[model samples]
Target: MNFPIIHTNFWDAVIAIPIIMIITQLTKLIYHTPSKFVPTIALFFGLFISIFISHRHDLLAGVLMGWFYGYAAIGNYAALKTAIKSYRNANK
Candidate 1:
């Protein structure tokens, strides 16, 4: 299987992941998404952005990068939340 030549541009570096995170959070806040399904919702948003907007020219690349974007955002959110909680506990 030949891999698509995916180019990582400014959008991928600075935009896509945060956009996915923001959209996912907004969806949670607006629709009251359950915590258990939040990651899946992020994944859907990531796939939609990657497939329809960012990597439209390459289907394989889009799907692959979409997963990364989704998981990366999820991880980032988790890490940030943990850090804040730790800080609050320490302060208390």
Candidate 2:
């Protein structure tokens, strides 16, 4: 099986994941998305961005990177929330 050469550029690291997270949060806020569905929405946004925008020429690369982008966003959100909650509790 020939794997596509996936190049991780500035867009992937410094842009796509954060954009996906922001869009997911906006979707949650605008449509009142339930917390349970937020990750899935993030995944969809990741896939859309990766497949259509970032990794447009390679389907395999797009799917793989899309999963990474989605999961990374999800993890980042969870970690940030936990840190903030801990900080608040510590302050209080």
Candidate 3:
């Protein structure tokens, strides 16, 4: 099996963070009807972005992009859960 080499570049990290955030937010908004879909959509979008946009012909960019997206997704998910809980509590 052939393995790709990894090289880390500062600009790749800069571009990846916001892309992940945007994808995560879009997934959350569009799939509001079924909250479970948000994370799945985010994961797929994250993989897609990392594979396409962050492609540096190296694995490092891919790894970083995945890490950024994963962390951001978790944060977004937590925020959504908290908001839903608060809304439910307020209505009670």
Candidate 4:
């Protein structure tokens, strides 16, 4: 079995942290949800779209993926807000 080699280089860490922070910010802005969930949901959406693009290898598919990713993220944010409101009301 071939295992992927992981590197722990300083340069890699420097580049990776900013990229992660940017993604977290973007997800929070686009989704308009809490910052806490942004990273998790953004990574999930990014991974799904990335995999789809890699397998399909189509430009149009990539564009569609971007659109769907945004739509899904926004929808998720709305759903989250609604659920929280419902829970609060129920508890009160």
Candidate 5:
């Protein structure tokens, strides 16, 4: 199997991931989906964006980068929750 070329750049971390995360949250809000499905939805959306928008001709690269996009959002949310909890505890 041939591997597709993928470049990891600043946009992936700073722009794409955050955008994907926001989209995921918006989707959750619009659909009224359960909180547990957020990560899964984000992952599917990532794959869709990568395959259809970013790397149309490069399926492998799209899948790989899509995984990153999804996971980054998940990690971001987790970190935010942790920080909020820490702040609340410190203040109280």
Candidate 6:
């Protein structure tokens, strides 16, 4: 089986991941998604984007990069949450 050629680029981290993160977070807000399911939802969002939007022609690449997009969003969310928590604690 031939694996699709995949390359990581600035767009993946800078643009795609953040967009996916925002979409996932907003979705989570609307749905009241459980914390355990958050990453799973993010991954699906990434996979959807890769398949339909960004890397439609390259299935493998899309899946791989989509994984990045999902995790990246998760990480971003976690970091932001941590910072906010720390700020609140400090303020109190």
Q: Considering only N, C-alpha and C atoms within 3 Å, which residue pairs clash in candidate 1?
A: none
For model 2 the TM-score comes to: 0.94
TM-score of each: 0.94, 0.94, 0.52, 0.42, 0.86, 0.83
Output the better candidate (1/3) by TM-score. 1
**Native-to-model Cα distance after best TM-score fit, residue 79 in candidate 2, in Å:** 0.4
Ranking by lDDT: 2, 1, 6, 5, 3, 4
List, residue by residue over 1-92, the lDDT tens digit for candidate 1. Answer: 77789876865847988888899999999999899999999889888888888889988889988888899899999999999999999998
Give the number of colliding residue pairs in candidate 2: 0
User: 4-52, model 5: which lDDT tens digit per residue?
Assistant: 6686677656877788889988988899999998989888878887777
Task: Provide the lowest-lDDT 10-residue window in model 3.
Answer: 55-64
Which candidate would rank higher by lDDT, 3 or 5? Answer: 5
Angstrom error at residue 88, model 5? 1.3
Worst 10 residues of 2 by lDDT: 8-17
Per-candidate alpha-carbon RMSD to the true structure: 1.0, 0.9, 4.8, 10.8, 1.6, 2.0
lDDT leader: 2
Which pairs of residues have clashing backbones in candidate 4?
A: none
* Model 6 TM-score relative to the real fold: 0.83
lDDT of 1 at 2: 78
lDDT of each: 0.89, 0.90, 0.65, 0.52, 0.83, 0.84
Clash-forming residue pairs, model 5 = none
Where in model 3 is the C-alpha error above 4 Å?
Answer: 1-4, 31-33, 56-68, 76-92
Model 5: lDDT of residue 68? 80
RMSD of 3: 4.8
For candidate 2, write residues 1-92 as lDDT tens digits.
Answer: 87789987876767988898899999998999899999999999888888999889988999999988999999999999999999999998
Q: Report the C-alpha lDDT of model 6 over 1-91, residue by residue, as the tens digit.
A: 9777776678757888888888888988999988899889988998888777778888888888888788888888999999999999999
Candidate achieving higher lDDT, 4 or 6: 6
Model 4 / residue 55 / CA error / Å: 6.9
